[model samples]
Target: MRGLGDHLTIGERIAFYRKRRGYTQEVPAGLVGRSTDWLAKAESGRRRPPRVDMLAELARVLRVPLGDLLGQSVLLEDDNQLDDVPAVVMR
Candidate 1:
């Protein structure tokens, strides 16, 4: 069956998550300090994808993992593995 994740490009993925999170196009653009026109072009694939740093910011504004925007999400099949995750101290 066709699904939300099916046949999605990077741009479409951004749009999908933005909508799922109840954000208007302008909302994420504004939060990322970019113009709606720029965000529109990104969502429509009229321009090259944003640079990695900018994409990271966009992911942050959209409240999604950077990997999701970059299409690198990995699934942990075992929930118990969460206990194995180590906490990190950021300097």
Candidate 2:
């Protein structure tokens, strides 16, 4: 199956995760200590966060790995758990 990280910009990925987590723009914006305008700008691709730590906080609030927010792959499946379904997400 395709992942959320595929064929998406970083801003698109953030909006996707934010919506999936049932967050209003204000929710994560507040949680990450930013204004709504900041998040809106980010989601709209009008701005990019200047710090990796800021990105990490957004990922935390949205319950996704930072790599996912960055539109990069995150492999969560364990090799020993071959019987379980894989939930790998990729850039």
Model 2 has an lDDT value of 0.72
Candidate 1 per-residue C-alpha lDDT over 1-91 given as tens digits, one digit per residue, 9 for 90 to 100: 1245547666787888889899899999998888999988988989777776777788778877666776655344466221222222222
Off by more than 4 A, model 1? 1-6, 74-91
* CA lDDT, candidate 2, residue 70: 61
Local error of candidate 2 at 36, Å? Answer: 0.3
Local error of candidate 2 at 48, Å? 2.3
Report the error of model 2 at residue 83, Å. 26
Per-residue lDDT tens digits for candidate 2, residues 11-89, read: 7888888998888999999998999999999888787642566877888899777667765545555663223222333
